[model samples]
Target: MEATLSLTDKSGVADVRRRAIHMAQALGLSEKLQADAALIVTEAATNIIKYAGQGEITLKSFLEGASQGLEIIALDRGPGITNLASARTDGYSTGGSLGAGLGTIARHSALFDIYSVPGNGTALLARIADSRDGALNGFQIGAKSTPKPGQAVCGDAWGVRQIGTHLWIALLDGLGHGPLAAEAANRAVSIFLLAELSDKPADVLRRVHQGIKTTRGAVMAVALFDTDKRMMSFAGVGNIVGIVSSGSETEHLISTDGTVGYNMRTVRPSDVAWSKGSVFIATTDGLSTRWNLNRHPGLTDRHPSLIANVLYRDFARDADDATIIVVKAT
Candidate 1:
């Protein structure tokens, strides 16, 4: 159901391409679809080499009854994309070889989303559905922020939106540390507060990206919790991390692209349907991924603010700012 791959060197690219082809064949995807997937993966891996210098890829497959599909995530902490619109354009490239990397990926997958920021990082996620039954309209979500030890917290941001019985939340971690990040995060929250009242998660993020262009950009994750469908939908950029906890199982999600601001273009986001008994958590990279989830089992059940505080207490590197948001469905 879950598999991880890393592309740290030249050889890794070939390996990723071969493995992706193998997985596509095993899933019984059409020959055309399988080949398309392989090409996109290859292109993405090449982009990682050309841009990030190094990166990792994760592939997660989900099946419900006879339906099956795949979610591919590419992550890197490189120089980040400075002009997303130009990058996604037909012939835009910093390396000067027909800049159609993102555009090609968008054309190949059923769904594609990219998030990035200057001086931060980048995250790219794509989903390919093998059958109509495999398509899920549920939700996927994530959130991140920065919490200082003793600041007035002028820039904290959070929001909750409801559609029928479905509810969604978004938290942000702005650029830089201290008040600057807080201001960015707060502005993001403010945007969510206003837009969530009657907008989709993608639209909400678009507005946030546009709103923060004047200020320093921020890292953001938006989550939609569908009670009727019993699923959670998410999309994120920059350093935000999202995790799902079900009973004793925990699944952590790292961003696929970069942050918002300066150079980011409008990004298409990804979605994941949540199973029952799942808890969602999102945070800034200020909290280390190396933190032990086993030792802190109580994390899934805590309040968002408290969860942020606990992560700050237990794993914050202190060299950077930290923040977290926790959501659990009963």
Candidate 2:
């Protein structure tokens, strides 16, 4: 379950908090965890009202590694925090409000990340794990999918499959936004779940192309990362963006220009060598292509989720179903 709630005033804080608690219950989080979720979102919402003036709080249920729980990303365009370090300390407040803020949220969160630039705004992420799960393993992957405004479901879908060191990631953007588009994306993911593990990117795309032909059809990309071999093989249809970055250098992955399950052209997959601390990113065209990572210093070292949020926070077009997958080789 996922929702992007707008907090325009103090009343919006209660609404965001209530929805967060409900999502926590739906995800089977413990009472203690539910309370923590409530606290984190409430504090985040309050911060937006008291400082940013207007902002959004997104609550999403996610399954990462062996853990399952809630992920919250709070975004605002108000004056950015000048000193993040000082703001994170307990009992620290800029306005006449309670000091409980980032420090308390960090303590309750299994993962916490914040990125802000003065006058550019702030993006913060917190992941709270279910009580029964306490560990994370395998490939480190982070993603955010937002539906077009006024739509109930996003036309974009993604799935991940990992066996030992062989990790497969797929990102699909259906023809358009809303129900018809979502139909194509959901069907493709079903076929992906049942596909053979040995299938390369081309094989996977072909199977999905055949399986989802009845729907609106979609533009899809699949990447297979063989961590042990330090190689990545990828293929796709249409205009999905695939990128690999290490240090200051970047490389692109090629995707043929055609709609899958409809007018698909011959499938071709490419490969690139993985370097130490390299990051692989895949995104639907819902984001502006002009976004550059170099503008934000030291952001690459943060969690993949943080990186994804920062990109979405800055570059999302807001007129279409948007999704981004950030993968790091373990």
Error of 2 at 58 (Å): 0.9
lDDT of 1 by residue, 110-154 (tens): 667776556655667666665534322343333334345455453
Q: Candidate 1, TM-score vs. the true structure? A: 0.50
Q: Which residue segments of model 2 deviate by more than 4 Å?
A: 131-136
Q: Please provide, for model 2 over 138-177, each residue's C-alpha lDDT reduced to its tens digit, 9 standing for 90 to 100.
A: 4578888889988988999999887887888899999989
The candidate that wins on TM-score is 2
Task: Give residue 23's lDDT in candidate 2 (0 to 100).
Answer: 93
Residue 152 of model 1, lDDT score:
47
Clashes of each: 24, 0
> Looking at model 1, which ten-residue stretch has the lowest summed lDDT?
134-143
RMSD of each: 18.0, 2.1
Q: Count backbone overlaps in model 2.
A: 0
Tell how far residue 74 is off in model 1, in angstroms.
39
